[model samples]
Each structure stands twice: as C-alpha cells, then as structure tokens.
Target: MTPFFASAASFVDPLDEVSAQMHDVTSKPLRDIVVAGERLVAVGDNGLIIYSDDHGQTWLQAAVPVSTDLNAVFFSDPLKGWAVGHGAAILHSTDGGKSWVRQLDGRTLEALFVDYFEHRSGLDTERAQSYLSALLSMTRPGPGQFFMGVWFDKAGTNGYAVGPFGLILGTQDGGKTWQPGNTSIDNDDLLHLTGVRQIEGALYITGERGRVWHLDQSSKRFVMGEVGYDGTLFGITGRDSTLLAYGLRGHVFRSIDAGRSWASVSNDFAAGITAGTAVDGSGLVLVSQAAQVAISRDEGTTFELLDVPRPTLYTGVVSMTGGQLAMVGLNGVTTLQIQ
Candidate 1:
C-alpha cells in the first residue's frame, strides 16, 4: 500500500473490519497476482483478494480481515499462504485463498524491531544505537508502513518480506514468528527494498539505487552482489541460470552467473518495469507501468515489445495456464494470450 500521512499519536487498528459480502472488484485496482495451485490469486487496495479457477474468466472475492491495502502476496503451497501490506500487516491463510487471518501488524512490528535491536548481539554501541534509532523512526506505530514484496522457499519452511527503508523480515517456521533481517544485509543507506526472489540456490533482493543483494551461505547474511544502474530496481525474475533485474526509466539488466556480473538489456519503452516473471517454457515476460509488455524468448537475452489490449498502469504479471498471462494493476486484472 502507498503512504498515508497521519499524526504520530494517531492510531489506526490494523485489523479493521472488512465486509464479507462478495462484490465485483474485477475493475478495481490490483497490485500483485500469483498462482496458487490451480487458483489465480490477485490482491490490491481495500484489502481485496480475488481468486479465479477458470483461467481468469471470472473472479471471486476472498474473506480478508483487514481493510488496509495489500501490496504483495505469496503462497508456500496451494494450502498455505500469506499477504502483507499497509499498516505493516501480515495476513495468513491455510485454505488456498478463500480466507485470511491477521498474523502481525504495525503495533507488533514496532515492538519486534525495538526488541531485536535492543537485544541484538555483536554490535558496537554506536552502531547499535544508530540502528535502533532508525528502526524507531521507521516503525513509529502507525499505518503508513508498507511491504512491497514476498517470497517463500519450495518446502514452505522459510520465507521473506521486504519493503520501504530496507525493511526485511524473515520466517524460518512458516511465518509463525518473524525476525528482523536487515542486520545481515549491507544496506547502509536504508533504501527501500522493493522485491525478493529465490532463484537457483540463493535468495536475491532488489532495492533503490540499483542495489542487489544475495544471501551468503558462509556468512549467513545478505551481501551486495553487483550494481548495474544508479536507479531503483523494482523487481527481479529468473529462469534456469539467467536472471533479470528491472526498474526505473525502463532499465533492465541480466546476469547469468547468479549476480556475479550483469549486462544491460535494451528496452523499447522508457517507462519503468514494475513486474516480471518466467514463463514455464516460453521464456520471460516483463511489464511496465505504462502498460507495455515485453517478451524474451531467449531467457532474457533479448526482448520484443508486445501490444497490450488495454493500456493501464501494471503492477504485477504472472504466467497462467495454457500459455496465457494475467496482469494486475490500477485498472484491475487483464488476461493476455501469447503465441
């Protein structure tokens, strides 16, 4: 969810009541979409989570407990999933995408960070104080906090959610508990962490100023991998050994050796790339905020622009069943077929 200004003393319940009745939200703003088993789950503003089982021809609303806008969602499996968004809220669901329960929120998040920094080990007094101060300023018990991206491992045992000002939270036991993960990363500037993905055998995070980080196995921490452009990177996706990081002003870069190096890839549009995903057998797809679509048939080596039926600000894209694509954004969900 986007930021909303409010008094520091003002308090908004993160678990605000949401309606249970179903409504036609197909044309509402949607931020992210994912495939959970055979169901297509899309989330957006007003705590909306809509699912479709028939290739996005029709949609059904899910039961969400909070009214805050949900920015990102991920399913460890068809049966277990989580959604995070404004007010620093984390919602969990066990039955596909039918219903969700509040797991954590801004109030709890503030406490968690304060405790972590106050009791953290191996930090110099000045550095620990600096970290604690930053966390206190960022997690100020309010509703403006936002989570931009989320990803889970194959076995659903580990997961991560990242967002504004280098906010990173990790869960080792299926989101039952979350711990601050920013201490391990090398984000001194505290830039906004936009996306997280587990590709190949490691986890990669993209953030502001073209910063990319990979989880170091030996150190058990996230280390800076490489920098390609000076602009912000919105998202990253990979297929096999090839990876793509895309962001501000149509910038896109590819790395084949797991973030060791990168090469700039030419893009047709000047608008920023907001989302990307790997197709099962067709290659990679990247969508921009200008509603432009690009297809890379050679594992992101090269891309060609594709025509969009209805141009709108696209926030997320996912490859669907039968070589189809489902996109969600300001104008809601749209399905595209590629040959």
Candidate 2:
C-alpha cells in the first residue's frame, strides 16, 4: 500500500487571490530583460538570444555568435550591444542580437597561464619558487565571476558585469578593455545578478540571497547594502524612486529611500517568485514557481492569479516593453499579452 501525508497548503485562484486561489514562463534561463530601439531582447542559458520587433507582438530566435550560455546582455541601441557569459564568452554585436563577435573569452586566460607555467618550469628552482610562480601565473582576472548581469551607465561606453564569487568587471572603452572593481564580499557561490540600476548617481547590484551591493564612484569602493530577506533575490526593478526586489518564498522587499534599507511587503503566495514587472504603470505582476502569475496593484500588498497556458516548471517568464511578456523553456517560446 502507498503512504499518505496531510498538509495545510491551500489553493488560491489567480483571479480570486485579490478577492479570494492561485496560479503562474522563457527560452533558456532568460535571466535578464531589456528594451532597446523598439525591440525587446531576452538573453539566457546556452547562448539563447531572442527579440521582438513590433512591440513584442511576436518573437523570433536571434542568432548568437558564441556558444557559451550567455548569462547577460545589454543594448544601448538597436544597432550596438554586448553579451557576456561563462568560460570567457564575451561577444559584441553591431546589428543588435542577430549576430555577435567574440571579444574576450575566459578560456584565453587558461591558455595564457598554461604557457606561463611551461616557460617558468625551465628555471629549475627550489620547490617554493615553483609553487610561488604557479600561483602568480594562475591569478586570472577580468570579469572572473560566472558573469550574470550586464549594464550600461546611460552611455554606450561605460559598462559593468557582476556574477559569481562577488566579481565586478567595468569597462570604459566600449568593453574593448575591462578593469576590476572593488568586490569585498567573501561568498563564492553568488549565482545570479538581476539588475544594476542607477539610483542617485550610484549603481546597485541585486542578486542571490538578497545580496545587494552599491558602487560609490567618488570613493571607488563597493559598499554592501542591506537586503532584509535571507532568501535568494532573483529580480529587482525601480519604479519612480522605489526599488523593489523579489525572490524565494514570495519574498518582496521595497526601498522607498533609495535602497538604504528595505521593508518586507506581504504577499499571498508562499512559493518562490521568479520574476516581477510593472504592469500598465499602476500594478505589479509576478511569475512564481507554483505555475502561476500573480498581479498586485497596491505595491505587493496583495495578489491576483492569472490563467496561464503552462506551468512555471515548463517555462520561464521574460517581461518586455509595454507590459507584454514572453516565456521560453522546454517547448521553445510563447508570448503573453493582457487583452
């Protein structure tokens, strides 16, 4: 005979959650969403690049020049952009995301160290000397993290990429050259960085475990910010002067005072939230792992579920411009719009 267990979980409708039950998308991981030149581009796992031309009416797969999983992409214009990912996979595109050119790859660093080690071994010094030489040569740098997010500072030149192991890489010459930024965090498994927004002349990075960090240009240091939730923070968006963050266990934190401190907001769902976006300039929408889409009109105080076509396990949500959305995962890509 099979064993049975009882639970206290309740079903909330997506539509009736606000009044009453509940419900909840992408191609790859579809980690980041951005709008450029009337086009909406979403980048994700396995070098997946997709875009919508006519205000997200439909989406088509865009060709990527690299093979590595593109964790992040940013376009200042429809004509020019850059995408970065693991294993030194940094690509540049002049024709949007249709095609890309390999710029800087991390594999080159490995090859560089290989050559350095082979040459140094001929010296035949003491064991201490050999060990020290190998250590120095292996210190590969420049976007060293498993890059998760990329952003431009309201210009085509200055840019930043943050990812695993608290790595921060900045470029001034349009990513032709990159330099390291001050990352003091000691954690090594900092997986995803969702958004790097400019608030009050400072850049803030939001990511896993409610990890938020701020960059001070004047002092040239990265100061960690307070993210009250211990759960993973996968997305962050700025509306007006408020910075909203969402993550595991329906985690929602808002900072009305420019990300200095955060306050927890009540939410209906108890499962992890995957993505959140501002809808119609008045309401916020969230896609959670419970295979449901929840909408909150009053700044996440409550939620309403939507009837979606598939479960969250089957798709990932990528929010687009004009409140349109796209989901990609197991069965390719699907588009969603509020009629």
Q: Candidate 2, residues 141-259: lDDT per residue as tens digits? A: 32343566677765678887665544556778888866544223323343345555554465777777687777756675556676876667766755556667777887878887777
Q: For residues 21-131, could you state the per-residue lDDT of candidate 1 as single tens digits?
A: 546788889999999999999999988999999989999999999888899999979978889898888888889899999877776787787777777635787877788
Model 2: CA > 4 A from native: 1-31, 109-145, 183-195, 199-202, 314-322, 329-331
CA displacement after TM-score superposition, residue 113 of candidate 2 (Å) = 11
Question: What 10-residue stretch in candidate 1 is worst by lDDT?
Answer: 1-10
- Candidate lDDT scores, in order, read 0.86, 0.61
Error of 2 at 196 (Å): 2.7
Residue 49, model 2: lDDT of 72
Q: Number of clashing residue pairs in every model? A: 0, 21
Q: What lDDT would candidate 1 get against the real structure?
A: 0.86
